[model samples]
Target: MLEINLNPFTELQTDRLILRQVRESDAPEILFLRSDDAVMKYLDREKMESLNEARQLIQDALISVKKNEGIMWAICLRGTDFLIGTIGHWRFDKAHHRSEIGYTIRPAFWGQGLMSEAMQAVLDYGFNQLHLHSVEANVNPNNQASIKLLEKHGFVKEAHFKENYYFRGRFLDSAIYSLLKPKR
Candidate 1:
């Protein structure tokens, strides 16, 4: 049997958000967002029906991080117990020095700029701590909010795949945006 090594998850803080590993206790709150149709509209999963489902999802996310499959971070407000959302980098290509970033925030927190703050911090970590040369985010073309958010952080559209994702029955296009390390 092959022994799998796990990365020790740690907590990160910025001025307005706390980024950390998702705990079992966060399953309920996560499920709430996971169940929100508005939130899941752009996500792969339709909805989570139970806390156990969210727990299982959390477990898998952590395992993936440990196995270097991905790094998932829960986004929480400073001094608060409730998790606002999640952010992560998957599709890592270490040899190429790049990765893909994905994030989601609760509907209540939308328009508050909480997610942007979290994203900026994580993107910085991806470039500085993870030593990545670039990162990308693939957003549904119709999701103007997400596209604008990525643009604010210097991500430029590299490609536009029309009718790429099957979401809620209809096909959707996606905008592939990428950010390269600033030239020093």
Candidate 2:
């Protein structure tokens, strides 16, 4: 495994979107994205209840980046700074050359192909810049859209665990998908 560096680039850009570090100014959008029941429906974590929570989340993400543990980027449209979503890798295991991918988008942006565009940039960063062997994502079995997106990116289903995650006082099933680096 190689020594990982979280701050490899200040920002990443696709044709329609820009992936940049999260900032305090993005709290309102973050709050809205994380608090909306529709947006949080399939996520295992509790919804963000206030702006403070969003700010804290941004701060924590920065800290994690500084520690080389993870990288989180706010997804914004080109020529605009308003955050519409987020995509990132967390739970990085340097020795294993792998990390878990996570993402969330504003409900308004759903079905627009924006998330898929942002994901490609992040995945390229992970495989090409971070030199990771694999990238994994965990999704609720019911989130067919997310599963489809992962599959579109060449990720293959690796496992399905029944009631593997205890969330909101009950166990929930999860599916794990992984995309490995192409052979050299």
Candidate 3:
């Protein structure tokens, strides 16, 4: 069996990005990302309609970290603290050494390859630092950009389930992708 701990939090860095702990001040950015039509287009989750909702989300992220339930990072530029997006590994299956990865970026930042950078860092931490056997991504089949990004990172499509779940008053399909730890 595998046991994990995320005390004191962990921060990741890339040439142009800093992935750090989520803070209350990130509510505005969280609100935008959770509510913006473009950002929420393929997301099956609920939208944040108010700053209060966003603040609650920030709290939830913090609690999840403290409980070792999961870990989330606020994606910001290296020299800044403002969050432009968020990424995390959650829905852990410790018995199997697997976890689900999810991310959301402001539409304004799309096409810049920034999310790709963040994803790579997170995947590395998941597989190398956390000793995860695999990382999984559940994406909306219509989300081509996300599918492409996952593929570029070597997450091969493992399954495509039609109308597997219902969200926002409709049935939606899921394209499941997974990346195994490289042979060592």
The numbered model that scores best in lDDT is: 3
**Candidate 2 per-residue lDDT over residues 3-27, each given as its tens digit:** 8887644599999999999999999
Worst 10 residues of 1 by lDDT: 1-10
**Best by TM-score, which number?**
3
How many Å off is the CA of 18 in candidate 1?
1.0
Over the full model, what C-alpha lDDT does candidate 1 score relative to the true structure? 0.85
Residue pairs clashing in model 1 are none
Q: Candidate 2: where are CA atoms >4 Å away?
A: none
After TM-score superposition, the amount by which residue 109's alpha carbon in candidate 2 deviates from its true location, in angstroms, is 1.2
The residue-by-residue lDDT of candidate 3 on 111-166, one tens digit each, is 99999999999999998888899999999999999999999999999999999989
- How do these models rank on TM-score, best leading? 3, 2, 1
- Overall lDDT per candidate, in order of appearance: 0.85, 0.92, 0.93
Lowest lDDT block of 10, candidate 2: 1-10
Q: Give the range of the ten consecutive residues with the poorest summed lDDT in model 3.
A: 1-10
- In candidate 2, residue 14 scores what lDDT? 98
lDDT of 1 by residue, 21-56 (tens): 988999998898889988987666578899999999
Task: Name the regions of candidate 1 deviating beyond 4 angstroms.
Answer: 1-6
Q: All candidates' TM-scores? A: 0.90, 0.96, 0.97
Q: lDDT score, residue 118, model 3?
A: 99
